[model samples]
Target: MTQDNLWQLDAHDIARQTTSGDLRAQDSVGAAIDRMNAVNPDLNAVVVDLSDEAMARAQALDASRDAGTPCGPLHGVPVTIKINVDQKGQATSNGVVALKELIAPDDAPIVRNLQNAGAVVIGRTNTPEFSFRADTDNPLFGRTHNPWGRHISPGGSSGGAGSAVMAGIGALAHGNDIGGSLRFPAAANGAVTVKPGLGRVPAWNPSQSAERGLLAQSMSVQGLITRSARDLHHAMPTMIAPDPRDPFHVPMPWQGRALDGPIKVAFTKNTFGYDLHPEVEAALDTARDALVDAGYKVEDIEPPNVFDCGRDGYRALMGEVYSLMKTDVDAHGSQAIQDIFAVYFQEFPPFLETDLLQIMAKRSHYARQWSLFLEDYPLILTPFLPRPFFKPDRDTEGGEGVHEVLGCAVYSYAMNFLGLPAASVPSRLAHLPQGIQPINIQVVARRWREDMAVDACIAIEDRVGRMCRPLWEHMASS
Candidate 1:
């Protein structure tokens, strides 16, 4: 296969070729690195390049193949890690310049898990500072622009992973979601992302100690971003292997079972209190129609309280968890921490003692409500965001106010807070400046129900087909 073709093949296809001896692992890794060099300068998706190490690992895989040694499922596939995850020698910057030099001494559990499953970590992708906002931009690595349009954002905090996948730099990239980080960017840039239920894929930072509060433990989950839904199907099982590092890591059986009859989908065009832009609404309508035509029962309903959970409880919990990083920031470097906090304090006032208690109380109540809601509705079909795509902004300004992009977080952040498995699936191309016209719907199920989520994605893929990526030629100069 041509080098360009190697870059475009999904992880499963690459693995099949390598396992069958049709393609050598080293050749595939070299081609992937070359493609990264060819396109990264224009897109800036990958912030750290591990070309040498990746090539070495690829060569080892080839030698093993020749020696007739059995290989793991994802053998020799090139992938990227979002910089927020620990990958040994590299720092998990999380877009904070002050912590850029804070090197990780060991591979994050998920990184090691991927490596054990035979995936190569070719590089680290960019993220927003502390992943606080929806758009991926920070002083450390600047911004991850959409491959569809340089003038727009790729979505954060996994924006880099999303952009890199769209540019055909990697078949898969590791990403974690605390808010909409994984899903929105996947939606923004025409890719697919799964925020597996908490502990479905163990997440830990060996460089730092454990989190301290309810929100701290509740709001975060780790998973992958990829061009094809099948990549996630392959990754979810491998990544969820038992890891003692994350206490929350569950050994629940992956639902590798058959889909339970025709799937039931609940579609909500607008968030509870928000308006969906015409393009986004139309894209969602198209997806609903497609699902209906595919013989799945699609019902339009008020997506249960996801918006209120995010606005009222999720944000409060996230603020508390993020504040825990203050010590890490202070010990390593404090200037950036102070600057970001200054902005944060200005925007959202410190909660009164009573207000803080109220937020915490509401969290427990909200979690129960969401649990009951998911019992009847096995799947949800909702827009990832009200807007089709957002343009690049130097800061959250313009007459739209902080709430414009901030408000859209409800569609994604709520699932993270609830510890439910959710996915961002692009429905189709629409009239968006990003060229990759995309609509993302969050597919949710009970905790540890990732198998159901994947099945829904496969169902959607069988119906709509995966998003058509930009040709390498079109994105080469992007």
Candidate 2:
């Protein structure tokens, strides 16, 4: 492997070499910093650069290793944290201008976990205001352009994380998903990510003044977006470490007990009445074929009533946001975000009072249905979106655009409502008239079986191949 291209290496390789003393932490951090400087000005993926701090940490890690401290699993690996998460002394801006000065007094659990595992934080990535959109652009951070091309929207909330990882700024990018934040960027950028199930990873921001809404707490999760699935596998175990801050977090082993036979994958192409774009359908086919080839028992099966689960779930979340967070949003949010939320309320129609509690209770019914179905098939292969990713600002066009970008994403959000681990991995690369884009498929595993979802993503990736090589070629030529 070329030494200069160390920034392009995956977390698994970087950690393996660094742990064996064949690579220095400083070298990995330096290469990542170089990559960030070269590409980030164009993409704006990393809004807060921490190159100097990263190098210092790398040097310290190297000295510790020299002094005979045991190497952690992620030793010397470069990673990026989303700005929404707390990093002590750094503002947990969440892409809001008003919060730009609200520096966190302590690191979030995810940050501490990554540092404890020896992963170097290269920089903080961007997000939409309040980290609440399907696309990334904020008054504070401007926008995150897709590394693939200017025409595409880097999927939001986690868009910066997705873009940074794919652009070789880092091997791993920390991101959170509360209804497709992780999956959206992974799909749009041809990156891979697993939205860990409820409580799979500890999540608590030290800068947060109040606890999140009930649905928000249940639906949202901390995870990573990576160029390849192996990087997720290499880093996620460390992310799941027990933290007293998150009392609800479930302490469990990364790998579950093996099944007795070939893993059954229930596959579906049902787009829930939305027109399934040919590219997306083709991507689902590719995933199905890949899994079958990889020895998974693939069967055609439609996901059970995801439309209802998604619709009611989002409405309930909107209610909570309206009840608890709306004041802050209205007070501090930009006009654009405020308008977007207004439209969101119109489309999703927030449930209120007793209705909110009723919907919250109904969430369990939907989860139970999926749980029973998952028992028959350990995994469900489905479409992440009904169509190819839309252009930037697609959601800003009002109801139609939001419908196009989000309404068709039932598969993506229903998993969140059900609190099941769902992995998104690119299966097809299309040379569209606008630009080259990647289409991703969804793999949902049983509750608390994020490893299973990631395992399936790896199998699909091994067959279809990683997206980074082609993406790099495009970047060099463009």
Candidate 3:
């Protein structure tokens, strides 16, 4: 492989080459750093560059290989760590200005797992303030622009991870999702990601002062965003490795038992009264057709009450935020974020006190319904958003903006609430008058079946083709 284009190689390919002595780990890391230097200026995707340390680490890995040490699956692949998570000497800022000076004393589980598996951390990515908004911008890191163009938002909290990985700064980008953070950025940047089910990937920040709410712990999950679906197969296994810090982490292997013959998939286009954009509907049809072609039995059947579940779940989450983080947000957050949260409360009124507890308890009822529905159909194909991704700061337009961006996105966050694995992949690249952008579809798998969801994403990707080629072509031309 040419050194100049080494940054474009996926984690699987990079590992194979580096492990077989066909490529040098130092060269691979250097190429990625060069790519970050070349493109990251305009994008602002990577806020903290770790090139010096990454190069030193890559050299050490090469020396270890020369000394006959057994290589990990990730070998010498470069990956980015989201700033929200601790990484030993780095700051766990989570895009908040007040926390910018708060340094971490140890590595978060996700960081340790990735580095342990031989993936070098090249840099730290940005996020929205408090990591709450759908768009990526903060008082600390400013805004991360979409690689497609500035016309689109770099979908939030994991926005920088999505942008950096897709822009060739890293082969894999570590990102966590509480709501739609992982899939939102994947949809925005045309990347592939599987939001791991509850306890699939262990998570904890050593620098934090207190424990999070029960709902926060249950809904939040650590995951990765990659440029190709096949990359997930190579990287996610190591990511799910158990950590002692998170006692709740499941010890199950990444690959589960293969289902008998063709898997049945439940398909739905129900937008919950929101107007389903033609492009989004086309994207769903493309995914359905792709699954059918891949020998999966696709049927048009709605899986439980997604609208009710999504609404109640987010409202419940808002209540948790209100009780737990509201004061901090009010005190430390910028006016823009404060305004966004104000709109969030208006859109999904929080249930307080006893009502909050009752709604939290009702989570099982929704999960149970989806669990039964998945028993009949192991996979569900649905629209990630009712339309193509919105423009930057569209969320700042007020109530209608929040409704358009989040309210219409019932399918994306519903999986997060249910604590089920969901994968997002591009099924169509819509050529709008403004510019070409990818349209993504969501695939929800049964609990602890993230492997299944990724498999379905690969099947769809096989038909629709990967998004990186056109994206790179655009980047080169521009």
- lDDT at 96, model 1: 82
Better of 1 and 2 by lDDT: 2
Best by lDDT: 3
**Tens digit of lDDT per residue, candidate 1, span 166-267?**
787878888878777888688878788788887677777888755546665667787888888888877678888888978878887776455567767777
Tens-digit lDDT track for model 2 on 354-431?
Answer: 999998999989999999999999899988888889999999999998888887888878888899999999999988
Listed in order, each prediction's TM-score against the native is 0.91, 0.99, 0.99
Write candidate 3's Cα lDDT for 36-137 as tens digits.
999999999999999999999999999999999999899899999999999998888989999998899999999999999999999999999988977899
lDDT of 3: 0.93
Ranking by lDDT: 3, 2, 1
Candidate 1 minimal-lDDT segment of 10 residues: 394-403
Report RMSD for candidate 2. Answer: 0.8
